[model samples]
Target: MHRFANPTRFLRLAAAVLPFSAAVAALCLGAGLVWGLFFAPPDYQQGDTVRIMFIHVPSAMMAMGVYAGMAISSAIALIWRHAIADLIAKASAPIGATFTFICLLTGSLWGKPMWGTWWVWDARLTSMLIMLFIYLGYMALWQAFDDQTKAARAAAILALVGAINLPVIKFSVEWWNTLHQPASLITMEGPKIHESLLWPLLLMIVGFGAYYLTVLIFRVRAEIHQRRTRMLRMAQADRHNAMQAAD
Candidate 1:
């Protein structure tokens, strides 16, 4: 961990792994889409409409996963004062927010046909909505500060506290009288899905995870560059002022 504390070293490592992450993401998404759209049998109830779950479910899974990643990174940044960890938490906010939005939008589309309504006050849905707001609030906190260091610290604290929603999203159906279905893939009674469908769902999930990694690396790289550029500009300005003083 300490070995790669230097951003330059981390960038080199990231460069090596970036292409592989993209490749795996492409491979997994391609296979998942093919299997989900054609190879996997249609649902007995919803028929073709059920196919949307292949994308929606995985995005929903990733939404929560990204938040959890941010929360952990936030904790690490607070305790260990790791710059990369803070960068990760900051860089991932918009992506996770986008994914959460997709989950809600797609879920609503799916629910319309199945539940005969576009909106619900269900526990899971409400919690997911709250997740989105929390993400926005975190981002706002970061940008509202003139001091970047203070912004990072404040956002990290918000992220750690917002983590309480993860469990609520997970166990929502079990805990409340809600219209949302309980866990299908991961449960104490084992998966309720068929193996043929399960494989594609897993593939889509892995693809989503890989895609997240790829995007995160890109965002972090850009952020590091921006910081470097800012530092360089500051140094140049300082040097110019020093030269003028000597004159």
Candidate 2:
């Protein structure tokens, strides 16, 4: 694991995985949306409003899931000083943040019909909102310092601290009588969602996840290349100065 921590080596590995990931994400997403939107039956209660579930639920799941991933990466980076982990955490931030935002937006849209309001002060909703802020904070910390090691350590600790929010978001329903619904997919007796809506919803969730992974690899690779380029330029400048001094 440490051996692959070298950015150059990570770049090579990422390059190899990129094509396969891209293909899988694209295929899964395509099929998932088609099945979710078209083939699936509308909810008896929510009707076409249920259509939002295809996009909303998956994005919400990914939002939390991605943050968890970021937290784990942050831990690895802080403990092992794994270079690639920082790259991954940095790359995952915007994607996860976007998903969280999407979850909130779509939920509002879904709520306007069902809950009769665009927003709620429920625990789940609030915690998720906080999670979004945490994402922004993590990104800010990474860029706040001029020193790389200091920045990474600071951001990693912040991420770890924020991890408490993950479980809060997960069990918010059971912990309190919030407006948010309970778990539909990963439940005590399996999914409570009907088969018609269930499969498509799952597909979309998976597709969204794959999409995040596809972009994460590309972004991290670019970051590695950019750092390498910066190093090369600095080295070139130093060598040029040394040669001039010799002359």
Clashes per candidate, residues 3 or more apart or on different chains: 0, 0
Where model 2 places Cα greater than 4 Å from the true spot, the runs are: 1-5, 165-191
Best by lDDT: 1
- The window of 10 residues in a row where model 2 has the poorest summed lDDT is 182-191
Question: Candidate 1 lDDT, tens digit per residue, 72-168?
Answer: 9999999998888889999999999998998888778877877678876555566678788888999999999987678889999999878975575
For model 1, the superposed segments whose C-alpha errors exceed 4 Å read 1-5, 165-191
Candidates in order, TM-scores: namely 0.88, 0.86
lDDT of every model, 2 decimals: 0.83, 0.78
| Residue 236 in model 2: lDDT | 90
Which lDDT tens digits does candidate 2 get at residues 34-58?
Answer: 8888888876666777888778788
For model 1, state the Cα shift of residue 36 in Å: 0.5
